[model samples]
Target: MFRISVLARRYSTKPITSYFKLFPQNFPHGGPPQDSFIINPKHLRREYRNLQSENHPDLNGSAILNSEVVSNEASLSEVINKAYTTLKNPYSRIVHFIKVNHPLHLDLSRDEISKDLIKKFQSKSTQSSLAYKEILMNVLEVHERLELATSEQELEELEVENEERIEETEAEIADMIKYEIKDWDELMMTAIRLKYWINIRNGIKEWEPGKPMNLTH
Candidate 1:
């Protein structure tokens, strides 16, 4: 279901600027695509370090940037840094890979909208259908809470919830990839949800990292 092939690859190609490109061994065929997004941490870290050093202006190596062109080295270094940063985390890594390689959309099945928890969406629908309204409602709830959460306590709770959901989504992604399922609807749904919650958390932190969030009230 997930990307065993990608991680199992023996070798990879050299990447240009795309963060996913740095770890060609992870996805030799292409970025994620239909494969799993799981990458070995050791591989990623090693590649990141190598890329940084290779593109770094201070480093006097074969990857030497054009000294004649002012700021050329600096520009190259910045891009490399950005790429590494994005690919380091599973969340961002998956997002970046899919965004760059796959632009198509897949939705969750109807039976998936409802989860295991009672008073929830599970057992509420059938297979091969989408829970459109329920999905919209949940997304709305995320935005509402994001805009209203100001207190540190509130932020903490929100973080916990988001973290759990992210883990849940990732687990689902792994399972689906392992199973080698055909329809990607459920996988896409989880990925999209994780992306949304992650953005909400980042936006909040950036807008009110140290400031008193109680003012949001």
Candidate 2:
């Protein structure tokens, strides 16, 4: 199970500045889009409860229970389910925000990723599932490089090497909202690098030899 509070904290540490760029508060000429109205979790939950009370098939009297009413209730229930699912998951929420607010027009240059690299990543897998293991291995390799980095200047330089690619990927995401792109693979690679560097930097800050208490403040 995923922890929403943990994700919210992570995002707070690295807030999405680009979100405001993509979804501005107001335009110069007109009002915001209909979908731009933010759905409050409390309000949604209340609405759902109210809907259930009204649509409960058990609630029977002289009221003519039409088939159309039942169908509409089902549809509303489906919408409620979808809304809850999207709101609960951070990744899904992000994707939904992009889809609703800023549709992209992406054009991919590469047709296929390197098969040899894919094979190498696959071979490194100890079990039948290769994906998680491959990501972890990539992160480990980057962390090793970061450990060898001597100074803050070296770390900054390493970060600069990735900055351009990260920016390009962000732009690509903005443009190609609907289409698949080879750029996503590049973004994942860069994310792994960033994650490793972050871990290594934290390790250096809390460096210690033998004692368990060395990591304490």
Candidate 3:
């Protein structure tokens, strides 16, 4: 087995930015490719265990003598943990993929469509103009419905519908990447819409009657 500890030791001085590269046996392409959107959970878990076994500080025994080695091992272990976690969850994995490949597309700071962004979209009827406007309208409608839901049944129905939409969008993302679709504006907007849907899902989970809707973004 190619040991992750070696990589950790070699690059210990710097941040381990590429988590996928740390586990070559698992992620041969460095990161999950567009075609393979989600990894098999069991396979990922096995690899995570193997990597941790080789690099975990507590298991390193006498290697604790060298403070530098211990520090590096500890850091490596943390990165490994984060890598496993990020890859395990679907939403996080999608976000990570976008951030790594199309970084400029994802803006975590701004959730809603800004006036400037809307202007940019409205300036001309591009490939994603109609789709983007539809999504924007859908977002507003979903939020409004959520806000006015008087019964759990209404919220549950909304949840089911939104979950279906999320699944469809996820497939769209996979297809976009697999086919090398270059409409980055549309792709970015789709990802941002997913973020909103996820937040809405969370708010639905935390719903309370007669309380202000705890929706963010």
Candidate 4:
């Protein structure tokens, strides 16, 4: 059994800057680095807690001194916390991975809207853009489904069936991410679908029968 360690555990530590010149660069964008995609959450969490023990000024074990020192520790702690949060979740880690490792694959430049998923949002300038338009088309379609789910039976069925879609995308991503190198464009496409599926999941979880939802994922 993988004995999962609790994040809130206390330990002895030091000021991160006191020991090193650079902050933890393992997450943020372009981490695990450009060559790596798969992030072991357990490993990430272990590193995170270690850094948290040192950089986290809020923790008594993380050593606080004068006010100026406290401020610097506070800043380091903020960055570390963000990095840990981003790395812990599968979806966010994928987004950051693409941003860091393969900017060209994402190809934010060649379109009217720019790389805010340019391929998906582009206005039918090419065959692929036309297909990509389904991102929004699907969202609206699902929204209609959600609106029609005015009963618990319908909502239950909706989530139970829709969950498979999310799981499939996740499995695809897991397979691709296994390679340290990959076609980031394909991952991006899959990730975008995963995002919408997640939104639909969230919309369902938050919704109650007869109560309207904005459903804007």
Where does model 4 exceed 4 Å of error? 1-80, 103-116, 119-127, 180-182
lDDT of 1 by residue, 1-217 (tens): 2233442252222323334544455556544544456667788677667656643433443322432212444575676576667776655665554434332311111222213111222334653235645655676676667667668798788778877776777666666556444744355556655665566566566546444332110
TM-score of 4: 0.56
lDDT (Cα, tens digit) per residue for candidate 4, span 15-48: 2221111123343433443324445667667766
**Pairs that clash in candidate 3:** none
For 1-217, candidate 2 gives per-residue lDDT tens digits of: 1133542343222222222122112211111232322334565455445544765542232221322223454654564455556543323333444333322311111112223223433565465236646656655654555556666676676566545433444344334333443343343333333333344445555434332221111
> Poorest 10 consecutive residues of model 4 by lDDT?
1-10
- The candidate that wins on lDDT is 3
Question: Cα lDDT for residue 66, model 3?
Answer: 31
Scanning candidate 2 in windows of ten residues, the lowest lDDT window is 105-114
The most accurate candidate by TM-score is 3
Evaluate model 4: give its lDDT: 0.56
RMSD to the true structure for each prediction, in A, is 10.8, 15.9, 9.6, 12.5
* Estimated TM-score for each candidate: 0.52, 0.29, 0.64, 0.56
Candidate 3 residue runs with Cα over 4 Å from true position: 1-16, 22-28, 39-74, 88-91, 103-119, 126-130
**Tens-digit per-residue lDDT, 89-140, candidate 3:** 6666766665556434333234332333445555556655786678778877
